[model samples]
Target: MRAAELHGQRHVVVNVVDDVPPPKPDEVKIRIGAVALNHIDVWSWRGMAFAKRELPIILGAEAAGEVVDVGDAVEDLFRGDTVAIYGARTCGTCAPCREGRDNFCEGPQAMYGFHIDGFLRTHVNVPARIAVKAPKGLDVMAAACAPITFGTVEHMLFDNAGLKAGETVLVHAGGSGIGTAAIQLAKAVGATVITTVGTAEKAKKAAALGADHVINYREERVEGRVRKITGRRGVDVVFEHVGPATWEGSIMSLKRGGRLVTCGSTTGVAQSTNLYLLFQQQLRLIGSFGCRMQNMRDVMEKMAKGLVAPTIDTVIRLDEIEKGLARLEARDVFGKIVVAL
Candidate 1:
């Protein structure tokens, strides 16, 4: 088996091992097909695991693979089934997990490619519950982006923000992996999408993805453009993941009683808040983490139907993953970078 192990900051070594374990009673042995790169992978590469973790951890979080072996207790999955592996390790029996709120599980949670060994290897054993089977005929590369990329957007826009049809949404970083997914998903629900991009090229691509309006944040005041686009009103929802750099503007772009849902802090974390404006406007701020297991299924189904698909910026072999991480860290990618295993 071949695996990419991170020993320290910017140190990734691909190792070959002779021994690999089989699946447990409730687990499955997966032959990883493709691994999608996320900002979380960049954070891990930079030695930014916020929690305590041991060194030399495998370095992939979002991936899809073929099931080579299934545990005796796992009847839903079978040999040769293609599935997207969830990044977080949550106790399936926890109240939140049972209630379809897997991200809020009370048990000890560990994120793959961060706190624990990930799927950047030839094979891995994972709990069957976290392995979401992709719809038949969906390409493995596209399925690789579902667990985190599309699922996170699905959870953020619909579950956390309660985004509805006939509404307007401001999605920051519109050229990003999740941002591109947000634009398509929001539009599929009939929402008017306004997105922010850093470059004119990204602005064109964002608009092509069905964004009603695209703002080049580097060239103009985002909040000012957003207000003008809305005719001095504001958007019904704001899909925010870029951190403090855009935090204040994201707040100002939202309408009264509107929702702001955030999932990541790619930029620096802390930012000042206006409590008076928040209270007066009755705005809702939602802090969303990972998605429910069901969100992964929903996105995969959408992918199968050709309603949405991943925007793959590049594909490289596992040994070349460092280049992808560098691109993600530099904000040089338009969508996902997948590693063919």
Candidate 2:
């Protein structure tokens, strides 16, 4: 079997391992089919990780695969079933995990490609508890983005922010992977979507993706545009991910008593906020990460039903992963970059 391992910053090696290992009593042996790249992969490759991790870690966070073998205890999943593997290693016995709030694991914090070996390899065994069955109509490439790209938006918009139909939302970096997901999902529910992009090309694509209003942040101020588009008022919800660089604008784009949900801090983490505005507006700021197990199933159902679609920018071979990662870091992509195993 072959696996791409990250030894240090800007270093990735394709190494041939011994034979494939068998699954444990509660695990499933998965032959990974496709892997999706996220900012987390770029962060690890650039030595921006803030957690404790050993070297030579397999570097993929989101992926989908087929069941080559199932453990004796695995009952629901079987051989030849295509499934989306969850990205985190959470304690299933915890209160949150048992209650389906998987992102709020009460046990040790572990994420694939960050805390432990990931699914970038040809063969790997994972606990059957975390494997989600891909819907019948979703393909490997689209399923690969569900675990993170779509699931994150599902949890952030519905669970945390409670975005509703007829509402208005401001999605930052609307041309990015999660940004594209946020825009489509909001629009699918009849919400008016306002999105930000860096280029006119992306702005045009975002409009085609059902964005009601597109703002080129590089050419104009995001807050000013949001206010003008909303007729001097602000949006009911703000879908935020770009941090620090657009933090103030995100805060200013919200209506009174609006909700702002964030899942990433791509630019920088340390930033300032105004206390007076925080209390005066009665705004809700939510910090979200990952998603519930049900969120994956929900996203897959939406994909299968054609209510929402995966916005894949390109597909690359396994060895071309480094090039894909470089493009992701350069912000040269409009949607997701999937690497076929």
Candidate 3:
């Protein structure tokens, strides 16, 4: 089996290994079909990990594969079943995990491709509990995106922020992976979407993805454009991920009682907020992390039903992982960059 590993800062190499092992009693052996690139991949490549980790780690976080061999204890999965993997290693015995809020697990967690080995290889053993099987005939590349790309948006907008139909939402960085998913999910529920992009090309793409309005942040102010689009009433929710660069603007683009849900900080963290507006308007600022396994199941079901799909920028071979990460870091992609394994 072959694997893509990060040897050092800004150094990625593909290595051939012959020591692949079989699945444990609670795990399954998966033959990876595809992997999706995210900002986390870029951060890891750039040595921006939040925790201390050793070098020469596998370099992928979002992926999907075929179950070639199921453990004896895993009755829910079988050989040749397509499954999307949950990257966070959570302790299933925790209170939050028992309550179906796996993202809030109290036990120590380590993210794949960051603190532990990831799914960039041709074959890897995964815990059956974290592997969510996709619907029959669903695209493997699209399933690879379910764990993070679509699941994260589902958690941020619907689970945490409680986005409802007929509401107006402002999605920042509509050209991003999660941003594109947010637009589609918000529209699927009959919400009016207003998105922000960096280029006119991205603005047009965002509008075509069912956004009611698209604002080029480089040309116009997002808060002003959102206010104008909503007729000065502001939107009901703000799907925020871009960090300090768009934090204040995201808050200003919201309605008096609107909700702002954020999951990432691609533009760097640590931004100030207006305390007066937060109290006077009674705005809710929600910080969201990863999604639960149920979120991945919902996203795959939605994909199977044709409600929403991944907006793939391009598909590259495993050896091209470095290029994909570079594009993500440069913010030069309109959607996900998938690596066909």
Candidate 4:
């Protein structure tokens, strides 16, 4: 078996590894087919890990695979089933996990591709409970994004922010992976989407992705445009991810009593907020992390229904991960990138 491992900061190697043994009790052995890249991969490559981790860690967070074997305890699943692996290793006994809020697990945090060996390998074993059956007819590349890209948007917009149809939303970095997913999902639900892009080219792409309005932040005032497009009412929800670079503008673009859901801080994190404005508007700033296992199921349902689709920018082999990571770090992508195993 082959695995892509991070040896050190900015160092990745594709090496042959021993084949994973058959599934243990309550586990499933999978042959990974496709892996999706996220900004977290870039962060790890740049040594921005927020917690303790060992080197030579396998490097892929979102992926879909075929079940080669299932443990004896597993009943509902069988060999040759295609499934999407949830990215995190949550303690199933925790209060939050019991309530279906797996993202808020109380036990030790072991995020795949971050805290432990991940799906970059050809074969791996994971708890059967964490795998969601990929919707029938969903290919490996599309299902690969279910764990992160679409799942995060589903959780942030519907679960956390409570975004409703006909309401307006401001999605920052509309060219990024999650950004593209946000645009399609928001639009699919009949929400008016206002998105910001870094370049003029991406602005056009955002428009094509059902964005009601596109702001080239590099050349225009995004806040001004959002206000004008909404007739000064501002947007009902702000889909924020870029950190300090657009933090103030994201706040300004929201209407009074509006909701803001954030999942990433690709830019620098430090930023100031207006305390008076925050209190005056009764605004809700929700900080969202990864999605629950159910969120992945919800997004996959949408994918199966053709209500939303993954916008893949490119596909790379396992050995070309460095180049893919470099492009992602430089913000030089139009949509999600996948690695085919």
Candidate 5:
């Protein structure tokens, strides 16, 4: 088997590995087909991980694979079934896990691709409980994106933010993978989407993705454009993930009593918010992390029907992961970069 391992900061090397062991009674052996690159992969490649982890760790967080073998206890998933592996290592016995809110698991959790070996290998063992089956007609490339790309947006907009159909939303970095998903999802729900992009090309693409308004943050003031587009009323929700660089503007873009949901902070994380505005506006600030496994299932079902799809920037060979990471780190990709295994 072949695997991509991170031995040090900004270093990823391809290495040939021995055969994988058989699956445990509660696990399934998977032959990975595609890996979707996310900002977490870039963070790990840049050694930005806050926790302690061993080097030479396999480095992929989102992926789709075929079941080559299923343990005796795993009856629902069978051999040859395609599935999406959940990104986190959650304890099924915990209260949150039992409630389908796996992201809020009280047990100590280590995220794959950051704190543990990930799915960037030819073969990996997945817990059957966490492997959500992909719809029959969907391809691996699209199914691979369900875990992080689309599922995060589904959890943020619908679950935490409780966004309604008639409201307006401001999505930051509309060119990024999750950003593109946010715009499309908000549009599907009949919301007016206002997004910020860094370049003219991204702005044009964002508009094509059903964004009602696009702001070139590099050339124009983002908050001003958002306010004007909303007719000085401000937006009802802010789909924020860019972190501290855009935090203040995201706050300013939202209407009074509006909701702000965030998942990732690609930029520096520490940012100060005004106490006065928070009290006066009665705004709601919510911090969202990873999505539950059910979120992936819902995302894949939508992909099968073409309701929502990943905006693929390009597909690269397995060994070309470094190129993908570099592209994501530079904020140059307009959409997702998928690795074909």
Candidate 6:
């Protein structure tokens, strides 16, 4: 078997390793087929992890694989089933986990590709409880994206923000994987989408992805354009991720009582907010992390229904992990970069 591991900061290597054994009871052995790259992978490569972790950690968070074998206690799933592995090491006995809010697990921090060995390996044994079956006819590349790209947006827009049809949304970094997903999902439910891109190329791409309006933040005033497009009413929801560079604009672009859901801070994290507006306007600021297992399922179902699709920028081999991470860190990609095993 082969695995991509992070030896240290800016150090990624593809190593040949011993194959994983058969699944233990209540577990399933997956033959990983595809791994989707996210900003987390770039963070790990750059040693931006907030917690302590061992060196030589496997380096992937989102992936889909085939069930080569299942433990005796595994019931509903069988061998040969294609499934997406949840990107967290959550304790199932916790209250949050019991309620399907696995991201808020009360036990140890629930993170993959950071705290524990992740899905970049060719084979892995994961608890059957964490594996969600991919919908039939969904390709491995697309299914791999559901656990992170689509799931995060689904949780942010619908669950946290409570976005409704016909409302307008401002999606920051529209060329990003989750940003692209947000635009499509919001549009699918009839919400008007306004997005910001870093380049003219990405602006055109965002328009093609059903964004009602695209702002080239590098060349235009994002907040001014958003206000004009919304007729000064501002957007009902602000899909924010870029940190300081767009934080003020995101707040300024929202209407009174509007919601803002954030999942990442790819740029520098430090930012100050207007306390007066925050209280006076009754604005809601929500911080979301990873998605629940059920959110992954919902996004996968939507993918199966053609209501959403993964926008893959490129597919690289396991050894090209460093190159992929570099592209992501440089923000050179317009969509997801997948690694096929």
Stretches off by above 4 angstroms in model 5 are none
Instruction: Give lDDT tens digits, candidate 3, residues 173-232.
Output: 999999999999999999999888999889889989998988888999889888888889
* Local distance difference test values of all predictions, in order: 0.92, 0.92, 0.91, 0.92, 0.91, 0.91
TM-score, prediction 5: 0.98
Put down candidate 2 lDDT per residue, 1-341, tens digits, no spaces.
88888888978888887656789989999999999999999998887658589998889999999999999999999998889999998899989989998988998878999888888889889999999999886788888989999999999999999999999999999989999999999998889999999999999999999999999999999999899999978999999898999999999999999999999999988899987998999999999999998999999999999999989999998788789999999999999999898
TM-scores of the candidates are 0.98, 0.98, 0.98, 0.99, 0.98, 0.99
List, in order, the clash count of every candidate structure. 0, 0, 0, 0, 0, 0
Candidate 6 lDDT, 137-216, residue by residue in tens: 98888899988899999999999999999899999999999989999999999999999998999999999999989999
lDDT by residue for model 4 (109-213), tens: 899998888999899999998988987888888899999999999999999999988899999999999999999999998999999888888988889989988
Collision pairs in model 3 = none
TM-score of candidate 2 relative to the true fold: 0.98
Query: Residue-wise lDDT of candidate 5 within 156-253, one digit each (tens)?
Result: 99999999999999999999999999998898889999999999999999999899899999999899988888888898999999889999999998
- As a TM-score, model 3 comes out at 0.98
lDDT of 2: 0.92
Off by over 4 Å in 4: none
Model 2, position 57, has a per-residue lDDT of: 89
